[model samples]
Target chain A: MSDMRDMFVETASRLFRDYCTPDLLRAAAAGSFQTQLWDAMVEAGLTKAAVAEDAGGSGAELADALALLVPAGANAVPAPLAETLIAGFLLGEAGVVVPDAPLTIAIPRPGETLRAVRKGDGWLITGAVARVPYARFASGGVTVIAETAEGPLLAQVALADCKIAEAANLAHEPRDDVAFNEAPAQAAKLTTRQAADVYAMAAAARSAQMAGALQTVLQLSVQYALERSQFGKPLGKFQAIQHNLATLAGQAAAATAAADAAIAHAEHGAGSIAIASAKARAGEAASIACNIAHQVHGAIGFTAEHALHFSTQRLWSWRDEFGNDAFWELKLGDQAVAAGADGLWAMLTAAA
Target chain B: MEALSFAPPPVSEEAERVRAEVRAFLKTELANRPPFKKADSWNGADPAFSRKMGAKGWIAMTWPKQYGGHERSALERYVVLEEMLAAGAPVAAHWIADRQSGPLILKAGTEEQKQSILPRIAAGDCYFCIGMSEPDTGSDLASVRTKAVKADGGWVVNGTKVWTTGAHIAHYMILLCRTAEPTANRHEGLTQMLVDLKATDGVQINPIYDLAGQHHFNEVVFRDAFIPDSAVLGKPGDGWKQVTSELALERSGPERFLSSFTLLVELVRALGPDPSPAAKIAIGRLVAHIYTLRRLSRSVAGMLQRGDDPAIQAALVKDLGALVEQEIPEIARQLIAAEPDTKSTSDFVAVLAHTVLNAPSFSLRGGTREILRGMIARGLGLR
Candidate 1:
């Protein structure tokens, strides 16, 4: 958390709070996208914060860029801020042209690898990538990591060139499934640990976002408890409500701490252990945090109009998105078990 | 938004160096200890092991060297504590003295008290226990009625202390007693008196066995036990401040969460390399929590090192840690088909059984969950 990073957070956070109005959220959730908000973000140079300066980005530190996701998620900003920044940075890292619009990625999961056939000047991508976020309205394209005859190749393919069956996560953000039938793509330079790197970056981003959302619900729960009265006192005055909010606060705190660790480690290229713990911890914390938050908020929070739904729903969706707790936990558990009893502590304390 | 701050300090190279040294030392020290034996963790006392730690200058590490401390950074001490707990080294021998009592004595004790007590504590020969809990007063510590009446050149103590861990074997006890009539504030008249267990008269230690049938806990009765005027560790009516100041240190250690760490290791070993996805998921969730708790707890240590009060942060760690540690045995039971058995000859089952029997105390020990939650609520400005 440097002073320069603070500027990015302060500036972008103010912009988000001003532009990401409830009306804008409602419109975005109702299938009408908020272009003006995205414009504000782009004008503020947040979307390209992670891209290299030579590649026409704001050249903000990767950590500074990642930190913005907290406020973005906190405000429930219905935009592709984290994804675009990460994708743009990935493209630059692979020595490819950084896109100027909203971006998403097609990363292969544990046992799956998307393929690309080297065809002429560009590569022909062939894969059925599920849940490519923001692809439906992504003006730029989706970054795809395709396995080729020679190692792995990175490519950015236009959504118009592929079949996108539009869908939405619980938060109403587009999470469309894309099927590439020999889709022509810009053959970006290959990157090391291709899919894993992207997934790690995305998981770290999601962890930050999840941290933000957890903070939102926690505040909502506490504020609600303080305002809503019963038994001749405010809900916050009740022992039960106070305890529940305390639990929510713990969840929120753990998620925030976990997110900070994840970003810190991810920034240092600490790999799966750091990234996995961040996502797994944040997702796990969110499970308890969201439940406790909604429980504390009671019926008023259950309504679609309530802002609590915005954060909680996003948390539920985000946890399952870029690899859930179970998905990442298995990876960590595998490494730990393989290391055996003696090596477990070493693995755990290795990053520190 | 105003949650107690735990901005993790920059990763200390010194701490990492200490971590490596501790790991290497533990490797040789615990090479022969079985996992089930390790499951006893910090509760299992071994004077030899504690002496080895003391020789390494690991005990009373953050105190001044003149007081037999190494003057190491708190993070370095934290790294050592984390490694010890993870490896299940027998740290109970001097855990209390190292964690709180020695620090309290250094902060508030007379120079004579520090000269006579600290070096022995640092050498890991002397042990200490908190004489705070009584028969009726537990979480409501302000209501403690242990009396210390004025006597010739001293005070006479008459009361009983309950649930004092390691009391039967501890060399000394930092006795919290009522020194004066209660004022408008119940917490005002209490004082901390140093009690020499071996030298004291009419002091009886009766064992209070745990569910595991262990003698780690005790009931100490004092009937007109003389505490020389010099034995008062701090000023009269200052026990509340001293005890309150020590609360964060008592609650924020790796012991709070790592009590059942051996159980987690045993669970992982049982699951092996290629278990069902479900087992892996359970293990992963546990690992993630352990990692996060370490970060939070370490952050508290940094705060403590920087001379900041992190009572709220410490409470948060202790509360969340108790939930996670207690969740181990229950989750481990479901992840595997074996019933937790202390004598089944299977280390995993035995460790699970030990943990099952012990997990209930994790929340009960430092501060009960209800009390911790109340503290956290106050931290959240809800109370």
Candidate 2:
């Protein structure tokens, strides 16, 4: 294995083994307590992995840094890792100073729009950004704003600069809608396209996280099968259970490969096709694996006492975080056919 | 299970030249051949064409030159297979023999067997069939009831094997039979033997038509069929192990799921430009699936090259690849304006027709979807 994949496996395994317990997942989901796992991750320099060395980070490659977050999704470790790491990397790349605390970003719904107008010495942003993850805890946010003359622009605003209304999702991730009522903010150097690109990258990372969570759930289900016995032998020995695990393993493998490819593409400047492909595949695979894991684990998998739900729940949440399967599928389809048959052939063979 | 990190380094210029040479050979050979003809490639099973390939020293390319082989690298062999499949060559005649049986005998057969059989197989003058599946035993080889009782100098075999592809045309079969008394454990006491189809007495091969109305498969029954001790592959009780190893070869190839590739190419050609949104979406999803399957399949190949069984990985590929291939026809039906006609002369239409006809067997042939999922679960340590 490459050092990068090894790092990913090791980091992900640790979170599943140590912090992402059933109790921890329940606490995080119930909004009752914050798991210290987030602090531990930051202490381990995971959150700042993609941040530049100049910005008090390891300055690792964006893909490598993003890999660390996959396990977080698998374990459903409630933290601001995705938001903070991505925000930190973008800020660091643009020579902006990110706070020591975590940061996240939010976009308006697909049809909605946000506007940022120039005022006095700063920019005044007025819009509502929904489905913002880790908004309650993030110290700052990177918001997408559309300007009448400039097209689209990404701006960074402190949490104190905007109003946050707590929001809850089906998968138990913390979310909120942020309404900026003429909130003053500094303009990020990245253009709308750049911001979109960054968002796609983050979405790819989120997919990786979902992949990781699915893997964890698979592991848990397999473990359960071995210990849970019927008909004088463990269920793991049965062909039925074997087939389910095999399918899940394939799904997990697909998720990993797709996410890795996406990361590689992003690192090499391959553009949206790579990200779209990864997000789409990861979304589908994660959803399938999550459902299968719960099904295989049966009643236990659904209970709060079993840690399987911790990972599976996160898989469910992260798959929709950046871009859902439907969204990325359309994006990839448009680009692929638009490139024409020859273009599609080139892309397919080019990977070889 | 690990991500594919190291590429096989880079091929030398000479190696690249060799690949180009092979490509040139294929181009010349297939210039006048319709693209749809290439769709069946190896699976198309034309003996004459296979003989021509053998004449080019393509069959058993990795074997030593002394045994009618070219002593090429496995990677070189892989290139040939890929090119052949991509071009849709009719390689079925020598496919099994060249792929596994020849290789297996090379590894475990006696000097006499190698001298008599390997050369003929390399020449593509002889064909081989698998005698593993039985009426009682589907893919669960351990449950096989084909008895090969010990005799003075040989053995007497009696059993019925169903769904045996190319039985009527094959010269010999790699048979798995019960040699010893049935042990408490199902996988034990079985053996593999090379049965001569020409000399075997009381053996009947009956054609079994597939859904496509193709007589490509058969049910072969052996009654007191005799096989000398030398014909045995490896030792008794090794059949289970050997067959399991053989599956890595059987399941890992591009053929496991590429059966629908011709249809995909045809669909693209038929759709042309400015495809409807629905068509584009379907194609996009299919392409993504194909891409993912290729990567997974490549990883399995890498594992095999490194001397790893990767049975679980192979099963994973087969399950997913089958699904992807099976989905192609449905997607094509929705995307294209005209209904597929299997008997059509048009290359795209014909390939699509063939794929639609053959798609159901995709999940059923190698191992049923249910069977594969069970294996995957086991590999994941699930019950």
Candidate 3:
């Protein structure tokens, strides 16, 4: 890691640690936008970190931006910091002025379509994207790459112009259902990228977040095991609990490695295999880590009030987001199959 | 949480350049070998092949120049190792010596020992087997009953070492035995001694065939085998520390995860291009795991290169790598229906047979899963 990246991580972790309190998380869970948390993030210039300076934002590299996602996930921050960074990158890539407020990117699910048609100077975008992350709170508007008759077009549509049927993920983070009906939007031709690229980036983002959450889960489980006792000894004294925590530590390590690989590859120019394999491995780690964590924590972890759920719920929900483990695994498997027996080793090594 | 940190491995141009050369060599060397034979991988001992590797200056790659080493970086050595394992190249003839024993001797050997053995090992003419595990001791290594008593100008050793891989073929054995009586600390009073298997008197090696019916393991009985004073590896009563200091290198490597790689490669060939989604998911998940394991393993290699001991992280990799390696055979059977048959002419079936039989040893070797997890738990401050 570069000194710049280490410094950024230190700053971001401190900001998150100080602001993302349980009270703020609870308030956001109870139908409140993390206005204060998001404001602090913006005030720190983090919201513009992934955008280029010429694009009216901070000039931090894409990797520096992605590195911040780990701390965000670690604290279970009740805001779309990852989404905003990704949206800023995509919009900046399209030569659009990056937004300065909370932003979200629109990735259409299966059988869903978001289409854009030229309307005078701007384009009109119509159709719905299911479970668009934080769409209800995207004050900077949602960045969507909708299909057009010519090909695919990039558009930025305001939340007020679109109908947002509010929804939430497993952690009660906003994943609203947004529908657009000939909404006035600013659309441009994406000469350098496509919608699939956005999906991969988002998946990588989720992977980074999962890595962070897994770390927290491992820490929480170990701390709990040491504090809680059964049969006159700390739970950690038992071989069973120790082994479970050991497994959790392995998962956390794997997830962090996977996420770091994905971020590095993405920064070097995204290799589809690296991103795909990362999301797949990190998601797999999340599942195993969550199970072991909850098992070690026992009933206290199952309850809503326990601090463990903050990280665990985020892990459960983030693993499903930006395409699940099975989804990325199938894609990677298809690549391997296409590479065939002779080419599989070459493919994997070449990506490395 | 503090014990676990696998930073991304740094890329090395020199390592990448070495990778191409290694691949080209493996391509020609393994072109005619059948997949069934290739499945043997590092377990397939071929001294002639090992000598070829030595002639290429590929053995003892990271030692000092005077010790017949190339003085290359650990990253370069890693690239060579992974390439060999991935291609299922026969490396067992010099694997243990190159990976651990050679480094151990270099680190703690006497100048005489280094001059006599280091060059031979670098030339791949000398092989070494670890004489640590005894009949009564395995994971509880400090409790070893193999005893060595002081004799004239040397030590007289008497004990049996079981599961000593390559003991029959290895020219030397690094024997870990009790040099003094046990005290409150079981880890103390143990010492490492170098025994010349061929030259030593009253030392016998009996073959122990694995389930795969291969003579990869041996039971060596030393009945007062005289090891001269010059054969002592390090200071007396420091065997426990010396042996354990190498665990990170032993536990973290591509070999841990790439053990059954031939099966996966053959499975892809059998599945063809248009297999079921289930097949893709299984293959893809396995690929993801191998990729992640490689990252973690490489991170450890980098740590080793930087002179940091990553024993806990290494344990985590081995434990996880073993899980994935063991899973391949079980998962392969479900993706395609075929009884594992070593006699079958089909590459997939034969590789499957070999892999299934050998899968159990992946976790058992180096350290058992339970033992590694215990180590990790201790690293986590649980013990």
Candidate 4:
């Protein structure tokens, strides 16, 4: 199992490293699609990495497929790779045909809903979703879990048919405000439990990405401290700088462990508690790691020319994307409280 | 910088099975114990309870069976230790022996030493304390002034060791002292001697109470205490190598993070079924940290089992674990409005006072935060 994951990760890392250059990232942030990079990812069979072979994917285990995000995140790949992997799972499981082009997800925030009603044999999707990741580049479609009169159902709506207001996060990645005004869509029945699992998976993916990005932040800070000199000595020789990097390493280690635990749980069919903990822990790590990395690098890292921001900016944005630290902490805290004091240890041990 | 790897801990059915057994035992053993008393956890010594645990074959679990060990996997030992810690069991009597000293003996002891000491340790009839620090040495252990001079049948040690935990109740002390004159290389010419604290002549243990009025810490003055040649551990000049390995075992354990756990239990109990959003967020944050630290600590155990030197990784765990352990008290105070009082009747207040007073030592003991971070920086190739 570990060998298979190693092979898969090695392949994914090579592809991402070749295409996610500083020039490509800058162009993608400036309202241009990374066409060559996207084509390479599609040809490498990475777009549908997690789905079963029968369902138009490489038939790789979900854990191995999700492992690709770590390197992709390390390079700060400015694309909808994480979203596409998640979309593959949702669409393949709903028995819908996984598309060839880049796909995005319309996950509605709390107090918001996207509705789907019957329109002849097909369905029509209405309502709006704020911050639909990569909606502008999802040439295939936007996968959504829409509310129906009967129950919640899955829908794949064409991006061309919807209104997309281009928006960018801290890292300049596209997070569009997409509105579907009676857009024609392919629909399938989906349970409410599955819908909740989708949310958990999204949060888990963000955690993995944060874990990878934090590693880069640590590397950058350490390298800068060693190479950059002041007062006739490298900055790393100073106790203050060394201690700062040590703290950053600690945060990165915690996030990586948390993300690894989340992926393990996801593969084993135990998701909620682990995912919640991962998101909360990774979110906190992101905040601390970015602060230390920036402080160590000084003004050079703050400039656009340096590559440190490529990872730190994503960490800053991804941490708050799919339910920040406070959101998941509340969920986990509620579960712990409900279990009471006597049952608290039991709850943790049971999950293990 | 080399990337630090903390792979997922391997799962063992036997380990899980042992976890259930340990939990059941703790349930019965601690049924009548109150939170204030349980707060002592590994620091609370009880020889009778240690004997009971020894009878259960928990001590020396990973050692050879000939030395009264159970020959269990490292994962099984981890499960037992964590379960004991979570339930706040009094394990001070056998903790140091089972954790580092016995393992050290098994690694470097003479045949006679292992034959006599291992079984007693496994039986919980023997106890050991470390004699590494002195009045002039804390973090800089290589600069210890303690020295053992050559004698007729053994060596005579002379120097004072301070801040020695459990020295009063301990039967033996693993003394680190110079066997030769100091050279330019300070770490050289050092030896570790197994001094019989009670039987050895000229050894005086004076009590040094902590702020909480506890007698766990002590000052042992050795005025020419004699240790036999057979009591020498490994080579005479290998004390530096031996003690550092012993510390890796000491640094990355569940005890480092779970010292203030009893207070968390009381806080949860006081919060009841419903709590404010602030309280829930605070509690959830602590839980997330504990969950992550457990994975990191367990991964270090796996590395140790594989015979890898994870000294840098162990330092990182202790550095991070101590922070969360200390933070639990600060967060608990904010969530509820209760003044920390050691003499209070309320369980919450009493545990709070105990944890607040003890939190400072969490970072100080094992290794100071500054020292551990310096080691981490070295691992990162920055020092």
Per residue, candidate 1 scores C-alpha lDDT tens digits across A1-352 of: 8776789989988998898777788889998778888888888888888888898888877877899998999999898888888888778776777766788887877776688887777788898888788888777888888888787788888878889998999989988888898989865666565677777888999999999888888887888888888888988989988888888888888888888888776654425687788899888888898888888878888998888888888999999988888888987888788878668878888855
**Candidate 1: pairs in clash:** none
Each candidate's fnat, listed in order, reads 0.61, 0.44, 0.82, 0.70
lDDT of 3 by residue, A1-352 (tens): 8776788789889999998888888888888887787888888878888888898777777877888888888999888888889888877877888767788988776578888888888889889888988898898998888888778787888878989998899899999999999998854654445677778888888888888988999988998999998999999999988989999999888988888878766643234888888899988888899999999989989998888889988888988888898888988899899899988888887777
Q: Which stretches of candidate 1 lie over 4 Å from their true place?
A: A110-113, A267-271
Task: Identify the CAPRI category of the predicted complex in candidate 1.
Answer: medium
DockQ of each: 0.66, 0.32, 0.84, 0.75
Clashing pairs in 4: none
Give the per-residue Cα lDDT of candidate 1 at B237.
90
Better of 2 and 4 by TM-score: 4
**TM-score (C-alpha, index-matched) for candidate 3:** 0.98
How far off is residue A227 in model 4, in Å?
0.4
lDDT tens readout by residue for model 2, B120-148: 88898989999888887986768899898
For all candidates, the clash counts are 0, 21, 0, 0
Q: Looking at model 3 chain B, report the run of 10 residues with the lowest lDDT sum.
A: B1-10
**lDDT by residue for model 2 (A5-86), tens:** 5675586558555977767777778884363776777776777888888888867787777777666766676777777777
Give the docking tier of candidate 3: high
Query: In candidate 2, how many Å is residue B36 off?
Result: 5.2
Residue B79 lDDT (model 3): 94
Candidate 2 clash figure, as a count:
21
lDDT score at residue A168, model 2, on the 0-100 scale: 71
